[model samples]
Target: MKNFIIPAIDLKEGKVVRLFKGDFEKTKVYSSSPEDMAKLFEELGFKRLHVVDLDGSLEGMPLNLPSIRLIRKAFSGSIEVGGGIRSVETCKVLHEEGIEFFVVGTLAVREPRTFERMVELFPERVILAVDSKGGKVAVGGWKEESSTSPQELALKYENIPIWGYLYTNIDRDGTLEGVDTKPYVEFKGYTKKPVLASGGVASLEDVKKLMGIVEGVVVGKAIYEGRINLRELL
Candidate 1:
């Protein structure tokens, strides 16, 4: 296991921000220039990034396309984008814009057939995002809850040719709490696809705890809050 530590950038209103447990009202703006932040991550030698459009996730359409275009121009590494990508055309557009992977959650749960078609068209470019709260899968930017559990959803798409999974713990997200490995540990048993842990990663030790278990971890609040030194990942 490479223990890939991918940093995250959450965009809201064309600015970089982090929301507490997926609550838009509880947001903290970290930077006004997202591309500059992307460049900094590239300078830190990070090979991948996890970016979400908070506004898009709620509106069901990409509102930060201009900012994302700037970010694409600034960073050379692989980037996975999520939020309001509900159709294949949007995926195609983002792919043309240089995004390597699409982190899809709401679409997959709301319309599995459409999501499958996306995978069929893009192949290894789809990353299933299973954001969970109290063991149930949360959707629509984590504003709505679905009847499906993370395990069931993971297994449902296990046979599909997706890039991998980005499993986030909504309860721990942005809380600065230490990561809970049990959920990830249990989630791993359901599928063969590589899984990336996200939410509430407070320190390097938390990253170390998840090393060799999942494919990687997507950390945002911890890194932006200065709790995690970016260089240490190298």
Candidate 2:
């Protein structure tokens, strides 16, 4: 498959923001109206949008549905949502709300059975979030480190029918440093499922470097901070 780029809209307190290294305390608000941001991306010719509920990630449920709803209404395209999606019911609800993909991590690590059932129920709709930090998988909104390695967690769901994997290097996230293709290179060896590289994507060069290795890349800070021009990607 051709590599694609996904623009991210992380919602916190009903505003679009990006956090440094996944730290909530270091968030930088980009837009107050998520709907407008979603519209901008759609108008720019992006076919897919990545939305994360920052409040929901910590609160253990979807708290930004209002904002998300507006986004869904504004953008007539597929939307993959993450953060605080911990149950099968949540997935069903989000699906009804127009979310096409579910980005899940904590549930996959802490509740394997339920996670399996979710995949069984949703089939190719689940996107396993293999978020890495300090060589370990981070869960619980990136607040807690898991005992399992990124590869181990990924391999656990290798056989399960999912959308693919969102492999985020938590350490490099929102840093605008540059892409670290080493981990992603190593990560691809463990599974055949599509992997979407996230974090440290500082320039078009970084995106190009990752294009051949992974199925897609999720870009946020770089696009928001003026480092990356979305039109160029087209």
Candidate 3:
């Protein structure tokens, strides 16, 4: 674990929603305006924000850039976005809109050539999200399974100057069952990339637990449901 980053807000069609292990049908909407939640996170003293476009990513459409930009404007901290960001042009658009980090998942796994090109173009601005279910990497919003493991693909781009890896144990994601720290700790043993954990963070104790494995963990549901505090984190 490492320094505990603040709460992350995941949006789908302008609402704050979280699903169990990336299951779209299993999603639960918490807030109608993600912007409000983001503004609160900023005002509360967080230094970074994780905002995702769940709708756009699953449909293979362009990212929910409007929501992303709105959050950036509302936030005082750096904002990072993932989902539906499949092209260099789209990446640049998010960058220009004040997004400090761009997480590329499906594209990184499904299209290696493009991921390589993006690595050359954006370098540290990009992060490869290795989302997995039962230890096998999944893509297209975790609805499809791939043969590779999170660490396997992480090593492919580990040598590059990309920002880092956003490792999400889909099995533990959004369940609030507790974080699956084993994979994160194991992934850290293989590469030195700064890994930001996604999903399964339920309490401050969990934050303290991850401090020995990676740099930060992105908490979605826990923060939304008043399970954690944002101000104390930053």
Candidate 4:
């Protein structure tokens, strides 16, 4: 499989933004147009795009479909979206709107059966988002802590057709400090599934370090803050 350096375009109230450590109140708007950012990522040769509807994640449903639609219209590359995707119906809607993959989070751990059904239906298009903090899964936009550990959760779906896991360190998300590869290494060791690392990617070196262990890495703040150049990174 080809490794990916996916740029994340987080949407909040129709604008591109990034939140600090998953805190909604602590957010910084990077751009007013998500479509422009998506187009730029595609122009820079990124094969895939990671988009999250921050408002939808908090509200328990997709709230930025219009923004997503605009992004799809602007960028022809593969798109993988998350945030408040908790049901099969929502996935179907996004699929119809040109989304290539669905990153299911809150529903994956809280509703395994539903998630399994989605995997069965979508096949390789369903990726599980295992957002973690201190080694445990955090759900509902990182507002609710679950008893499930990332390893345990990955193990539970070992036999399923789910595409892979997007393992994010909630504490490091949008922090731009660096990444802790230990958790990703451990999760991959236990499940042997394709893993995509998210959060704390500060520089090209950070991306290179994670490339060895993860199938891909989702970078946000670093790219927006001009800390890493997408053109050069690609």
Top-lDDT candidate index: 2
**Model 4 worst lDDT run, 10 consecutive residues:** 1-10
Q: How accurate is candidate 4 locally (lDDT)?
A: 0.89
Off by over 4 Å in 4: 1-3
Q: Give the TM-score of candidate 1.
A: 0.97
lDDT of 1 at 86: 89
Displacement of residue 32 (Cα, Å) in model 2 is 0.3
lDDT of 2: 0.93
In model 1, the clashing pairs are: none
lDDT of 1 by residue, 1-234 (tens): 123788888999999999999998899999999999999988877788888988999988788999899888888889999999888989988989999999999999999899999999999889999999988999998999999999999989999899989999999999999999999999999988889999889998999899978989998998898998777655
CA shift of 119, model 3, Å: 1.4
Backbone atom clashes (below 3 Å) for every candidate = 0, 0, 6, 0
Error of 4 at 27 (Å): 0.6
lDDT value, residue 117 of candidate 4: 90
* Model 3 spans with C-alpha error above 4 angstroms: 1-3, 231-234
Question: Which candidate order results from sorting by TM-score in descending order?
Answer: 2, 1, 4, 3
The residue pairs found clashing in candidate 4 are none
TM-score of each: 0.97, 0.97, 0.94, 0.97
Candidate 4, residues 1-234, lDDT tens digits: the string is 123688899999999999999999999998999989988977777788899999989898999999999999988889999999999999999999999999988998888888889999999899989999987999998999999998888888878888898999988999989988888888889776689999898988888888779899998999899888766654
